[model samples]
Target: MTDHAQEQEMEIEALEAILMDDFKEIDPSESGVSTTNRCFQITLSPQEDDLDASNYTPVQLALIFSHTEKYPDEPPLLNVKSIRGIKTDDLNMLQEKLEGEAYESLGMSMIYTLATSAKEWLHEKYGQNVLDEVVEEPASTKDDIIIPHGEPVTTETFLAWRERFEAELALERAKLMPESALTAPKDKRLTGRQWFESGRAAAKGPTTVPEDSEEEEEIDFDDDFEDDDDEMLEHYLAQKSEKSAEESKN
Candidate 1:
């Protein structure tokens, strides 16, 4: 057989494997078509587990199609028919949709795709019959509909979230600084180089900066110098003491 026929056979086998009793091979002549083409029928409906038999208007459809000589390269002919309670209008609409899909799916196996689309459509349209049931359904029916959950946190996501959260948190904390958390007055010492760089040593006398004064700030790889801050403080104090001793000696 040609690739087209071989592909059709494989698709038929896959459908049978999946649908079991719900799929069947039909004689092309039965649908008033020539025997040269192959035909198939698949029954479709909302999942039985989702239906409320008591209040449900049962619906089932038969999606019938035949592979053409150039099928997959060209679209196949299809017919949708009511097998149970499905209406003529519904069948027509579904067939229209399948035809559109078949056009889009040219050069690929698509009967199974169409069948799946039909089943989902059927469920959307007819599956809601369960809502009409007078009795409350068991939780199992509710469980049938998966509640989509959040995506798992990946390393990339975690890092992105942490960056955003820390920025927001810092902004909020900056807006409120408790007085109890303020450094004690005695503990207000600058890094020694920072004091000299600030030009505070040029001041001749006591300059009391108002605690309430708004000081506009003008905004370093001195890493090794961090360990020498205490030594720098002692050096400055010793020079002041020596100057005082020389004055005393004079």
Candidate 2:
């Protein structure tokens, strides 16, 4: 194969490795085939070629590989687009801050974070309260916005936090379920108004016999045979004596 073709092949392999690594943290199977394709598209971008503190975030750098032509050594043309969320002013500030840095080669996510510490600067300069408020109503534009819309933030950085947030929400739902279930009336497995409705239904239900009904069915005992008992005993004694005499003779 030509050197250019060989270079493209290597870039593809590297990009695939990054995506596979992501699969470790997230279930690609659950996400769908499109997710892998999307990841590939990002990984093959020209922005990846210029990955550095000056050029892109870790996510942006990872995406560059997939954007390159199959023959990479012919000089890949970058149609690099930033992800949404970063504001336009923020992008200017980021570029100014990253002036001296140049991406020699790509590295892991942490390297990107370290290289682009612009977020940290923004927080420190603007204060936590202001930054938090601005982040909520993220700027929506394509004017090469730096922080929010310039490029999508790496999922490695944000997805983990999002998953934890989701888990906490699920836990909160679970916590409420038992309380509702326990307070629920026998006729229904819900609570509050439903419980009240269930209680009404139970009140209208069929009347069952009392658990002690067997005891109520029992009859009282009496000694009515006592008067004839003595006479019977005397007769039995006389018969017993006659039988004894006959046995003695035999």
Question: What does candidate 1's lDDT look like per residue over 1-250, in tens digits?
Answer: 3488888788888889998887898887765445457788888877565554334446777888888878888988788888777777887798899899999999899989998999888888776773453367556653253437977556688899999997876554433332333343647644335443343334335556778889842223255345444444455566678889999999
Best by lDDT: 1
After superposing candidate 2, which stretches have Cα over 4 Å from the reference?
21-40, 43-74, 88-250
Q: How accurate locally, in lDDT, is each candidate?
A: 0.71, 0.40
Q: After superposition, how far is residue 174 of candidate 2 from its true place, in Å?
A: 59
Q: Backbone collision count in every prediction? A: 0, 21
**Candidate 2, residues 43-122: lDDT per residue as tens digits?**
21112223342333222222121223332323232112234334557545555453323232322112223233533554
| lDDT computed for candidate 2 | 0.40
Please, what is the TM-score per model?
0.48, 0.22
User: Could you tell me how far off, in angstroms, the CA of residue 26 lies in candidate 2 after the best superposition?
Assistant: 20
By TM-score, the best candidate is 1
List all candidate RMSDs to the true structure.
16.4, 29.0
